[model samples]
Each structure stands twice: as C-alpha cells, then as structure tokens.
Target: MKGISILGATGSIGTQTLDVVRNSNDDFKLIGVTANSSVDKMKEIIKEFNPKYIGMMDADSAIKIKEFCLENNFKVQVYSGMEGLIKISTLDEIDIVVTSVVGMIGLKPTIAAIEAKKDIALANKETLVVAGELVMRKAREEGVRILPVDSEHGAIFQALQGNEIKDLKKIILTASGGPFRGKSKDFIKNVTLEEALNHPNWSMGSKITIDSATLMNKGLEVIEAHWLFDCNYESIQVLVHPQSIIHSMVEYRDASIIAQIGSPDMRLPIQYALNYPKRKEKVAKEIDFYEITSLTFEKPDIDTFKCLRLAFDAGKKGGLMPTVLNGANEVAVSLFLNKKIKFLDIADIIEDAMTIFEEYTHNDITIDNIIELDEKVRKYVINKKG
Candidate 1:
C-alpha cells in the first residue's frame, strides 16, 4: 500500500483525492492531510481517513481541529501554518505527497517532500509555474519522482509511455475555452463573477474557474508542460477544444499525434498519480463515443484574454517573471472574486505587476527567493489600486 499526504485536503482536488483513496481497497492509505481554514471539512476528512497528521494553514482552524480530536479521543497530530505544512510533508510514513493545494503555497511543502525523498503527485501547477527550474532540479537531486496529477499533464504522461522523449515533437494542451470563450473584450468587461465561474465542462475551485475564463489557466498549463516534459515554451501549444474529452495530446517528430481521451473527471489523473507505472481498476466514468457527437477546436483569442498573453510572456522570460505573474494573477483573481475589482481588471493588475517585476527577472531561483518574490508581487498587486 502507498502512503500519501494530501496538502489541501479540503479543496476541490483534495476532497476528490480523498474520495479516490477511500474507494481504493487497501491499495492506498492516507498518512497526512492539510487544509487552510475549513475546520468542518477537515474534521470530516480526519474522521473518515484517520490520517496520522493534519496541517491547518490557519492557526485558529488548527486549534479547533485539535479540540475536536482531543474531545473525541481521536489520536492525531495537528499542526498550523506554513511550518506545519512542511513538517507533515516530511513525515516518514508518507511515501507519496499529493501537493494539491492551489497557488504558490504548495511550492514550499513540495520542496520539503522532495527533500524528504517522498514522491510527488503534483496537482499544484503553480509550484512548477513559479519555480520549475529549482523544483525539478531538487527532485532530480533527491531522486524523487515528480508525477503529474493535472489531467492534461497526466494525459501527456500516459501518451509518452514507451515512447522516447527525444522523439517527441510538441505537446498540444486542450482547453475548454471556459464560459467566456467566444465573447469579445467588451462583452467580458460586463460579465459578473457567477458568469465567469460557470465553466461548461468541469467543476473547479473559484481561482481556477476565473483563470479558465481568462484562458490564463491554459497558459499556466503550457508553462507547466514545459517544465514537466522539459520542452521549450515554443514547443507547447494550446488548442481551445469545446469538448474536454481529449484532455491533451503528444506529437512525435514522425508526425504522429497520440491523445489521451477520457471523461472530464479529475479522479482519473489523481488516482493515476498515486499508482504510477501501474494501472488499476477504473473509478471515474469512461468516455462514451456513442453519446459524443462532435469535437471542435479553435485558436484561443489571446487578444481578448490578455492574461493568457501575459502568462506566455512571463513563461518565456523564465525566472522570477513567472513567479510574479502567478502571484499577481492570484491577488487580482481574489479581488475580482470578492467584488473589490472588475473582472477585466484582473489582467490589468497582472500586466502591471509583470511590467514592474521585469527588472528582477534574473533574480536567484532559490526557494527562498521565489517565496520572497511571490509575496512582493502579491503585495504590489493588492495595493496597486487600493
């Protein structure tokens, strides 16, 4: 049995990861879990999984979880904040660390797990987006496997099996184009949060949903695929596919394209990460070619979704630029979600931060440097229009 620690045990991917673990019959075991502040959800997960350790990024939430565990005679170690996340990630029993937490917060714990020689099941693309060079190097040094847990990356992983990486031409990542696909900039400016959050294909967290609408999520994935597959940013392409069945495709130098097609379910990738180099009984739904009629593709409107363009620029620059871009986008998206800023302002804020942080694009790629830059960019974006 593989022992795993879930870093964001209460979020969309985290909860679904737990579902995957629960459904498995002794093939996987939960050793640790973490949450930001969802004490109720954390408590339910603890009750169900009985993980040995839990980290609550919010100190107050950790206190509540501790109280509940103590009152119920539940034996579990509960820690709080960033330090807690790192500690649990390095736990001895956890052979696999499922870094599912969104944003750059997952970066540090992922480094911790890699340093501990724990294989990573990476759902948090922001980890690679911000510090791909540093993170991938650390994984290599530690001799730890960094498996892709995102559907697109997982599809590429599956497609590349038994094929030499040297023979690969390019990776084509498919996007659902989100709810705002064909809408022009003028139309998007008037869109509300609910409208942007209404992703047509999959259920995701609010931050990701907003990123999808702006096509910035696809842009970030492009950067991630570059790091995961060790390909050039130019070699990674994105196609706006309305149907998400073809999650992603891999092209060879021989002009052959291999695609991994499946129902739009996150569980497939999550479980595949857990069972690396092995296939298990299916948990999620399979594709029904009979019911599926057509699959259409288009070029994403980078002119309309400037955030996507900004991501490409930052990614191509390749340093602290992507870190600043990810940080700025996070703050901007959070502000838009809270109604503190207009939806279109999200890209504007990111662009501003990118322009300002370009001077530091050559900064050190150390983990500490990345974290410092992430915080600086977030503060810059948060206070720019405040």
Candidate 2:
C-alpha cells in the first residue's frame, strides 16, 4: 500500500481526497494530514483516517483540536504551524504528497516533499504559479513526478499520454466563465458576494470561487500549464466553456485537438493522481452525453476580468513576479471576502502589488526565500490598502 500525506485535510480537495482514499483502502494508507483552522472538520477526519500525525496552521485551532481529542479520549498526535506542515511533508513512509492547501503557503512544503523524493499530487495552483521554474526544475532534478490534481491540468495530462511533445501545438483550457460569464462590466461592478460565490458547475472553497469569478483561477491555470507541460505562455489559450464538460484540450501541430470530458467532480482527478498508470472505481457523477446536447466555447472578456491579464503578464515576466501576484491576490481575495473591499478590487490590489514589487530571478530558491517573499507581498498589499 502507498502511504500518503494530505495537506489542507479539511478543505474541499482534502475531504474529497479522503473519500478517494476510503474507496481504495487496500491500495493506500493515510499517514498524515494537515489543515488550517478547521478544528471540527479535522477532528472528524482524524477519527475516520486515524493518521499518525495531524497539523493545524492556526495554533489556536490546534489547541482546540488537542483539547477536544483529549476530552473525547482520542489518541492522535497534533502539531501546529509551518514546521508541523513541513514535518508531515517529509515523513519517511509517505510515497505521495497530496497538496490541496490554498494560496502561496503551499509552495515551500511542496518543494520539501519533492526534495524528499515524494511524488506530488498538486492541487495548489499558487505553488506552481509563484515558483514554477524552481519547483519543476527541482522535481526534474530529484526524478519526482508532479501529478496535476486540478481538473484542467489533469485532463491535459490524460490527453498527452503516449503523445509526442513535438506534435503539440496549443493547449485549450476551458473555464466555466464563472457566475459573471456574459455579464457586462457595469453589471459585474454591482455583483454581490453571493452572486460571485454561486459557481455554476463546481463546489469549491470560497477563495477559489472568487478567483473563478474574476477568471484569476483560469489565469493561474495558464501559468500552471506552462510549468507542467514545458510549454510557452503563448501556446496556452483559455476558452470560456460555460458547460465545463470539456475540462481542457491539447491541439496537435496537425490541427487535431485531444480533449478529456467528464462530470465536474474533483474526486475523479484526485483518484487518478493517487492511482497513476491505473484506473479505479469510485463514487462520482458520470456524464450522460445524450442529455447534454451542446458544448459551446467563447473567448474570455479580457476587458472586464483583468486578473487574467495580470496573471499572464506575471507569467511572462517570470521569476518573483508570479509570487508577488499570487501573494497579493490571496490577500486581496481575503479582504474582499471580509467586505473590506469590493469584488473588482481583488484584481486592482493584485495589479498594484505587482507593479510596486521588483522581480528577482533566483536559480536556487530556499524555503526561507519563499516565506520571505510571501510575507513581503502580504505586507505590501496591507500597506497599500491602508
């Protein structure tokens, strides 16, 4: 059985990952799990999985979990903070590290896991977006496989199997166009948080839902594709497919497109990552082709959703710019969710942060540098807001 460590164990991806693990009990072992402040959910997961180590990024949450476990007479080791996360990432028995942690915080632990010679199932796009060059290079140097857990990248990976890289032309990434797909800029300006959170095709965490609304999620995926596929930014194109049936497509030089279609269930991709070079049976919604008669695609409105443009610029600029962009967006998204800023302010804040930062190219990025950059960007955003 392959031993696995799941980061962000209480979130949507982490919970679904556990479901996949439950389905393949005989094939996989849950060694460790980590979450960020969801004590109740973490407690439930600990009871079910009985992982050897559990971590909470928030110390108070860890304390709450520890007290609850003690009061309930549960025997489980609990840890807190970044060190705890790193400890779990480097666990000896873990063959695979499933990083579902949201935001730029995932970058360091993911690199640590890769350096430890663990295969990575990456759901955190910010990890790749911020440090794709370093992460992908390190994975290559260590001979570690970084599997894509995001549906778009996973679909592209599935389509690229047994295909020659030389024949690949462009990657077509499909987006749900979010809840504000065809709405005018004026309409979007007045969009409330509830409207933005109402994703048509998928159930996801709030940050991601907001990113989807701003088309920043697609932008991050574009950067992620560049790293995962060893392709240029220009070769990656985003298509607004409202149906979300076609996860993503790969176009060959001969003008043929290979696409992967499935129901918008993250479990399928998560399971695919866990069982590489094999397929497994799991409980998820299956697509019925007859009922869905049409699949249409359109260009994203770059005029309105400026986050996509900002991400592309950062991707092209390379180096620490993407890190700044990711960090700023994370802070901005948090602020927007708290109602400190309006929905459109998310992109505005990111763009401002990107402009104010100096891009540095580092051949060797230590965990320290990643943390420093993350803090610097967060502080920059906060100062700008003040």
Candidate 3:
C-alpha cells in the first residue's frame, strides 16, 4: 500500500482524493492532510481518516481540530500555516504527496515534498505555472515522479503510455467553453457571478469556475502542459469541447491522434495519479456512447476571452511573466467573486500586471523571486482601479 498525504484535504479535489483513498481497500493509506479554515470539514476528515499529521492554514481552526482530536483520543499531530503544510508534505511515512490546493499556496509544500524525495500527484496548476522550471528541476534531481492529476494533462499522459515523446507533435487541451462559450464581450461583461459559477459540465470550486468562465483556467493549463510534457508553448493547443467527454488529446508527428475520453469526473484522474503505471477497478462511471448523441469542438474564442490570450502571451514570454499573470488572476478572480469588479476586468488587470512586469521576463526563476513577484502583483491588482 502507498502512503499518501493530501495538502488541501477539504477542497473539492482534496475531498475527492479522500474518497479515492477511502475506497482503495488497503491499496493506500492516508498519512497526512491539510486545509484552510474548514474546521468542520477537517474534523470530519480527522474522524474518518485519522491521518498521522494534520495542518490547518487558519491557526484557530488548527486549535479546534487539535482539541477535538485530543478529546477523541486520536493520536495525531496538528499544525497551522505554511510551516504545517511543509511538515505534512515531507513526512517520511508518505510515499506520495498530492498537491491539490488552489492558487499559489501549493507551490512551496510541493517543492518541499519533491526535495524530500516524495512523488507528486499534482492537481495544482498554479504550482507549475508559477515555478515550473524550478519545480520540475527539483523533481528530476530528487528522482521523483511528478504525476499529472488534472483531467487534460492526465488524458495526455494516458495517451502517451506506449508512445515516444520524440514522436509527439502537439497536445490538444479541451475546454468546456464555460457558461459563456459563444457569448459576445458585451454579454460576458454583464454576466453575474452566479452565471459564471454555473458551469455546464464540471462542479468545481468557485475560483476555478470563475476561471473557466474567463477561459484563464485553460490558459493556465497550457502553461502547465508545457512544463509537465517538456513541450514548447507553440506545440500546445486548446479547443472548445462542450461535451467534455474528450478530456484531452495528443497528436504525434505521424498524423495519428490518441485521446482519453471519459465522463467529466475528477476522480478518474485522481485515482489514476495515485495508482501510477497501473490500472485498477474504475471509480468513475463508464461513458455510455449509445446514450450520447455527438461530440463537438471549436477554436477557443480568445478574442472574446482575452484572459486565454494573455495566458498564452505570458507563457510564451516565459520566465517570471507567467508568475505575474497567475498572481494577478488570483486577485482578479477574488475581486470578481466579491462583486467588486466586472468579469472582463480580470483580463485587464492581468494584462496590465504582465506589462508592468515585462522587464523581468528573463529573470531567474527562484522560489524567492516567484514569491516576491507574486506579492507585488497581488498588491498591484488589489490597488488598481477598474
């Protein structure tokens, strides 16, 4: 059985990961878990999983869970904040660390985990988007396996099972077109937060749902795929597939295309990452093609969703530019979620931040450099006028 630690055990991906572990039937053990301010959810997880280590981003929540564990006679170590995250991530007992946290918060612990020689099941795209070079290098040095847990990246990974990377042509990432797939700029500008959060195919966290509405999520994935696959930005392609059945595709130089098609469930990818190089009994439901009518595709309307265009631009520029883009988008999405800015303003803010930090495009990508730039971009976005 493989030992596992989930860094964000209360989030959507984290909870689903817990489900995978729970049903693994002695194939896996939950060694540690962390969460941000989800005291109730954390308590429930502690009761069930009884992981050896627990980390809470919120100190008070950590205290509460600790007290509950003590009263319940559960022998578990509870910690708080980044320090806690790192400790749990690098625990010697865990063979693999699942970096499933949202935003840039997942980067540090993921790096720490790699340094500790732990394999990574990466669901956090921002970790790669912000510091792909450094993270991938560390993984290589540690001889660690960085598994892709995102559906698109997972699909590409599956399709390339027996194929050689040298024969690869490009990767095709599928997007759900969100709720405003064909809507004009005018329509999107006036779209309410509720509408943006109302995704057609996937049930995700609010932040990601908003990113999907803006198409920035797919753009971020493009940057991530570049790092994970060791492919250039020019070789990555994004298509609008409303059905989401085709999670993603990879094409070879021989003009042959391989695809991983499945229902839009995150568990399949999560379980696949956990049990790498091996296929187990399925957790997600099988796709019934007889009931399905048709699968369709279109070119992503980058003109309408400027965030996607900005992501490609930032990714192509390389270096710390993608860091600036991700930092700005996190703050921008938060602003939109709070009803403080129009949905369109997100791209404007990210683009402006990217332009402001363009001179640092070729700078060295240290963890310190990325964190400093991220802080600067967040402050800039928070203070900028819409």
Candidate 4:
C-alpha cells in the first residue's frame, strides 16, 4: 500500500483526497494528516483513518484535538505549528505527500517533503507561484517526482504522457469563465463577496473561488505550467470554456490538440495523482454527453479581469516577481473578504505592490527574501488603505 500524507486535510481538496483514499483503501494508507485550525473536522478524520500522525497550525486547536482523541481512547500522535506540518511531510513511511494546503503557508512543508525524496502531488499553486524555480530545482536535485494535482495541470500531464516534449507546440488551459464571466468592468467593480464566491463549476475554498472569478487562478496555472512543462510564458494560453468539461488541452506542433474531459470533480485528479501511470475505479460523477448541448469557448476579457494580466506580467518577469504578485494578491484577497477593500482593489493592490517592488526582480527569491517581500508587500498594501 502506498502510504500517503495529506496536508490541509480539512479543506475541499483534502476532503476529496480522503474520499479517493477511502474508495481505494487496499491500495493506499493514510499515514499523516494536517489542518490549520479545524479541530472538529480533524478529529473526525483521525477517528476514521487513525493516521499515525496529525498536525494543526493553531496550538489551541491541536491541543483540543489531542484532548478529544484522549477522551475517546484513541491512539494517534498529534503535533502543532509549521514544524509539525514539516515533520508530517517527512514521515518515513509516506510515499506520496499531497500538498493540498492553500496559500504560501504550504511552501516550507512541500520543500521539506521534496528534500526527503517524497513524491509530491501538488495542489498548492502558491508554493510554485512564489518559489517555482527553487522548488523545481530542489525536486530535480532530490530526484523526486512533482506531480500536478490541479485539474488543468493534471490534464496537461496526462496529455503529454506518451508525446515527446520536442513535439509540443503550446498548452491551452481552459477556464470555466467563473461566475462573473461576461460582467462588464463597471459591473465587476461593484461585485459583492457572494457573487465572487459563486463559482459556476468548481466548488473550492473561498480564496480560490475568488481567484477563479477574477481569472487570476488561470493566470497562476500559466506560471505553474511554465515550470511543470519547462515552457516559456508565450507557450501557455488561457481559453474560457464556460462548461469546464475540458479541464485543459495541449497542442502539438503537428496541429493536433489533445484534451482531457471529465465531470468537474476534484476527486478524479487527486486519485489520478495518487495512482500515477494507472487508472482506478472510484465513486465520481460521469459526464452525460447526450444531455449536454454544446461546448463554448471564448477569449478571456483581460480588460475587466486585470488580475489575469498582472499574473502574466509576474510570470514573464520571472524570479521574485511571481512571489511578490502571489504575496500581494493574498493580502489583497484577505482585505477584500474583510470588506476593507473593494473587489476591484484586489487587482489594484497587487499592481501597486508590484510597481513599488519592481527592483526586487525574479533572481531575488531566496526563502528569506520571499518571506520579507511578502511581509513588505502586505504592509505596503495595508498602509496604502490607511
């Protein structure tokens, strides 16, 4: 059985990953699980999987989980903080580390797992967006496989499986166009939190849902594709497919386009990552082609969704620019959710932060440098509001 450690086990991706594991119990074992502060959910997972280790970033939450486990006479080790998450990633028996945690907080543990030679089923795009060069280089040095978990990247990986890299022309990533697809710039400028969170196809965390609405999620995927496929920024293209049936596509130089189609379920991609080079049967939705009328595609409106343009700019700038973009966007999203900033300000804050820190460049992306840059950008954004 392949021992698996799932970071951010309480989130949407984590829950779906556990579902995949549950369906294929004979092929996999849950060795470790980590969450930010969802103690009740973590406790429930621990009771079901009885993983050898569990981690929580919040100390009180971890202690509460430990207490509950003790009350129930359960035997499971509990840990807290970033160190705890890092330790869980390096568990000796773990063959695959699913970095499904959201945000930049996932970077350190993912790096630790790679250093330990654990195969990475990566869902944390921020880890790559902020430090793609460093993470990819470390994976190569350690000879560890960095498998893509995002449906788009996973589709590209599957499409390129048997094809020679030299034959590749470009990667065409599909977007659902989100809930605000055709909204005019004026309409989107006044959008509320509920509208942004209402993703048309994929059910995801709040942050990702917002990113999807703004098309920034697709932009980040472009950066991810560049690193994963060793392609330049020009080789990645984003197309809006409102149906979301086609996760992503790859075009060969010979004018052939290969695409992966599936129901919009996270479990399928998670299972595929776990059982790489193989297929597994699980309880997932099946596509009904007869009932579906048609598939529509359009060009993304970069005029309104400026986040997409900003992300492309960061990716092309390379090095620390992507990190700054990711960091500033994270802070901006938080502010928007808190009602401190308007929805449009999310793009404005990121763009402003990038301009202020233009001198940092892509080569200045040491871990310490990224952490400092992230803090600096957050402070700059917060102060700008005041």
> Which lDDT value does model 2 have at 72?
79
Q: Evaluate residue 363 in candidate 2 and report its C-alpha lDDT on the 0 to 100 scale.
A: 24
Query: Which pairs clash inside model 4?
Result: 319-362, 320-362
Q: Look at candidate 4 and tell me the lDDT of residue 174.
A: 96
Error of 4 at 27 (Å): 1.0
Prediction 1 TM-score vs. true: 0.98
Instruction: Give the Å shift of residue 124 in candidate 2.
Output: 0.7
What does candidate 3's lDDT look like per residue over 204-309, in tens digits? 9999999999999999999999999999988999999999999999999999999999989999999999998998888899999999999999998999999999
Look at candidate 2 and tell me the lDDT of residue 41: 90
- Collision pairs in model 2: none
lDDT of 2 by residue, 77-139 (tens): 888999888889999989999999998779779989999999999999998887887889999
Q: What TM-score does prediction 2 earn?
A: 0.96
Global lDDT of each candidate: 0.90, 0.90, 0.93, 0.91
Clashing pairs in 1: none
Clashing pairs in 3: none
Candidate 1 local Cα displacement, residue 315, angstroms = 1.2
Better of 1 and 2 by TM-score: 1
Superposed by TM-score, candidate 3 places the C-alpha of residue 51 at a distance from the truth, in angstroms, of 0.9
Regions of model 3 farther than 4 Å from truth: none
Stretches of candidate 4 above 4 Å error?
none
TM-score each candidate: 0.98, 0.96, 0.99, 0.98
Model 1, C-alpha of 364: deviation from truth (Å): 1.7
Best of the candidates, lDDT: 3
Counting clashing residue pairs in each candidate, in order, gives: 0, 0, 0, 2
